[model samples]
Target: MITNPSTSQLVRSVSTELRAKVLPELTDPALLVEVEMMLSMLDMAAVRADHEIAWMMQEADGIDTALSEAAVEGELPAPVRDALHALQLSRPADLTYPEVQRHYGLASEALARAADQAHAGDERLRSLAWSLLEGRVDHELATIGAYVAVGRSENQT
Candidate 1:
């Protein structure tokens, strides 16, 4: 529902900058990539959360009238299709940070990525989602930032 083009663009730019700036601070190139991947994954998670919230809204209303009443009532609604497509895009892989680590042998990396992505989303959600869905990504980003900092610092000395 919060579809401000300028705001969305700013959020994306800030997120990219944060990741790029932070990556060099950590000497481990592998960790850097892992963090990037995790953030990307988390970004997906935020999108998923948003989609779920939207779906819930639709379910409550029996139709997303805001998207398109015709779409919701008709056999094939543009809004419904659009929402589904966004949901599909937002759905994260079914791997948690630990699962991702164990499966890929990048647990720490997974954690960092999750955290970073969450943090980045948090930073943007205020400007992104105008409702309850706004804060979902904050926790993830904070966690990622903490882990990455700790790991990088531990390795530095």
Candidate 2:
């Protein structure tokens, strides 16, 4: 019987196979470098596949919590208000990529507008927006993890 492998599991298996088998067979320097990059990409893909959905969900929720308060303050710009309103109206129908992506897109827009408001000296909005921005940056940094350039001649350690 065939069992299902999680995306990360499958990606790691392929990466391991490439490193153990294909790497040994690669004779050309250029091909070795290219294959090393491919292995790095596979690692990245595994990490992203495991965490991207949850990160997006957290970011979306953070935006909603922060911007919902700003919406109540009644001082947001027209575009910002509209974006927030759209977020409120457009709940994700499911956890599918397209559904989550649609929700995330609206949240991103709302966050951008709220960030503009914050920059314009809305103190409460500023703190809230900053937290959201930091959370976004954290997610991005986590996805990138370490950036040691594998197989790049200049980055050889």
Candidate 3:
């Protein structure tokens, strides 16, 4: 979500490949299918990430109440206690809506990469990608997966 240098680099690399090499090589109609699949995956990832962010934000808001209630009522389940502790440990900014929006931006870039890469000179992949990119893809579709790979560069501390 923070868009570390590594994530930025990966997106840049994929974008360069899509524009410089992938697009030009796409001629076969079969590639469209791959494109479509990629789009579906992208959309799914974006949607899921969006949902998760929303849920997390909502959960964050309720943390104080939950923790207070748990302290008064009794001990909480291990997971609930862990979640509460983690929530307390996280900075307010980290759980803010802006952070979620940044994550959504990353999701979009990831989807774009998948769509672009679906062009393997196959008509299906091209068509798939095109249709999905153009909004022809179905509502009930797969997700555009995120690369958590940027985590390595994150300063968790």
Judged by lDDT, which candidate is best? 2
User: Which run of 10 residues does model 3 get worst, by summed lDDT?
Assistant: 148-157
Question: Would you list the rank order by TM-score, best first?
Answer: 2, 3, 1
Clashes (N, CA, C under 3 Å) per candidate? 6, 0, 35
Q: State how far residue 86 of model 2 sits from its true place (Å).
A: 0.4
How well does candidate 2 score on lDDT at residue 130?
A: 88
> Which of 1 and 3 is ahead in lDDT?
3
For candidate 2, the lDDT comes to 0.83
Residue 18 accuracy (lDDT) in model 1: 62
For each candidate in turn, give its C-alpha RMSD to the true structure in angstroms: 18.1, 2.7, 19.0
Look at candidate 1 and tell me the lDDT of residue 40.
Answer: 59
- Candidate 1 local lDDT, 58-92, one digit each (tens): 33232222223333444333333445334323322
Query: Evaluated with TM-score, which candidate comes out highest?
Result: 2
Error of model 3, residue 88, in angstroms? 2.2
- Sorted on lDDT, best first, the list reads 2, 3, 1
lDDT of 1: 0.41
Provide the TM-score for each candidate, comma-separated: 0.26, 0.84, 0.32
Candidate 1 at residue 27, lDDT? 67
